[model samples]
Target: MNCEATKCQCGCDQETDQQKYEKIAEIIAKYKNQAGSLIQVLHAAQNIYGYLPLELQRFIAAGMDKPLAEVSGVITFYSFFSTQPKGKHTIRVCMGTACYVRGGKKLVDRLEDILKVQVGETTEDRKYTLDIARCIGACGLAPAMMIDDVVYKQVNPDKLETILAKY
Candidate 1:
């Protein structure tokens, strides 16, 4: 693959579409006959391709000798599987009771405005994907937010910009 044309999330080296398919095919061959291995295969596919698009899902279905509906159903059933490409970084704003009462809605609104993308949408530049979380278990620090795995406590609209800049 031309690294100059498309860069993978890992930022090491990008594989051509053909190479990606071959790798996934090999994975399918490894576990095709294993009962209840669809989820595992899907997980590996997502890890390699980033997100499970309809086309890739179709390919996987055919390779695994499963119906498209079964594959699509699994993808939809799991929130972790995404049909669209995700941004390099994911930002989740907590919206639990404590957070909501502590200006979580305000933070969501501010993030929408700042990122120019609504909840579950990625920025145009693909730098960030915005999401809403029920809670991040930081009730004591209400209005908490997380960028990837790092949680920010007592987040406020005023600090959103600075927090985003660090990313």
Candidate 2:
């Protein structure tokens, strides 16, 4: 999405960088002086700006009076936190023991081929980001995959394209 172009990737009016900062600042103020509020602040920040870039992380560190290392540490420590921009839809393939044994790797390979993006990367059009999950607790549904929050059970490589089209 081009922030300077007036509309977001979804064609909605885009929020300026300054406006995003203001919102982040408000989030910081709301949680300031409260112990163990950094996670909440970071979550709000990521939601407001999509991802936590270094510059924004610095801004957050300064606003919350936290060391940059501390803020960055939290981001790195959490798998859910991303330092790069994410796609409109996130596709996570389950790679647990059951899923992997049932052809999880095939799913990953097919996605990489179709999306033209490796794991942990987003498509050029930002339509999707490919990822892997250790487990989604759907062992009974081995070879499962998830798009956004929807779980697809017993998925095979051949079914990926049709499933993705739904998004």
Candidate 3:
């Protein structure tokens, strides 16, 4: 679906990274002037570039005739808008009260050791990024962890070895 926004008259016709920037601008132009077009443009841009870099944000703002602060605000307000590139796999360890009391901290530590990267960091191979979450709404399955979108419940330190092998 074309994003509904008004196109600005910014001169983005140039070579180099600007070309890619203009390409994203064209997609935004299609959705110009439409209500709720911000998300659509952001989604389209991210889909094309993997992540929403600051340069692309500036380009989009200029092409859409929106303020840079407005564009930045929308980007920051939405969790779906990622400013950094994401890894192929995302591992989230829940550290809620129930999970923590159930040895969730040990599980997170195990993962960090095995992955050779700390929480909130991607592996050197870019295969995985480890993150610690407050809760995943899986209290019944305390000490839960999510690999990508699949929730693994009742995780223990011993299970880490087997799980790491699979990935």
Candidate 4:
């Protein structure tokens, strides 16, 4: 799932906001004429643009020949779709039973305290985003968290400063 492209395959890195809108128009044009392509087109749009804001939602709805309300409904119903922007780096703290029992919740609290950003929020500097994951499939490394793509195992409050400092 890694992209080695010099341009950054996510497209969020190279494109300015305006340029992203331009590419979004092309994405819409490519799939808009087809039937039952709303979800797929939206996926591509999200990939290119990072997240779907209200205006972006309206654009996509209009492009796909869908009602704005319907598009909004679909986005809100799906956890995979974000209505806000993400940060350059994302941190996911596991909240599953295993992780929670091992101080994962404390880690979440400490993150909020340290970053002054709550779960599901991006830091003011836009360097980091905080998220809560049900599980990161690392029960063996309970109290684990993932920052960007790096997993930190057996994390504790004492290690938070050191871990975050690496970024």
**Number of the top lDDT candidate:** 2
TM-score-wise, the better of 1 and 2 is 1
Q: Please, what are the lDDT tens digits per residue for candidate 3 over residues 1-167?
A: 12223432354432344445667878887988887788899888888776788888888888778898899899989877778767789999999999999999998888889989887778888888888889899999998999988999898798788886787
TM-score result, candidate 3: 0.70
Candidate 1 wrong stretches, greater than 4 Å: 1-11
Pairs that collide, model 4 = none
Candidate 2 lDDT score at position 105: 97
The CA-based lDDT of model 1 is what?
0.91
lDDT of 2 by residue, 1-167 (tens): 35664335555667877788889999999998999999999999999999999999999999889999999999999988899889999999999999999999999999999999999999999999999999999999999989999999999788889988888
For residues 110-145, could you state the per-residue lDDT of candidate 4 as single tens digits?
Answer: 999999998988998888899999998999999999
What does the lDDT read for residue 7 in candidate 1? 41
* Number of the candidate with higher lDDT, 2 or 4: 2
State the lDDT at 39 in candidate 3: 81
Give the TM-score of each candidate. Answer: 0.87, 0.85, 0.70, 0.87
RMSD of candidate 3 to the true fold?
Answer: 8.6
The global C-alpha lDDT for each of the candidates, from Candidate 1 onward, is 0.91, 0.92, 0.82, 0.88
Among residues 3 or more apart in sequence or in different chains, the pairs in candidate 2 whose N, CA or C atoms overlap within 3 Å are none
Q: Ranking by TM-score, best first? A: 4, 1, 2, 3
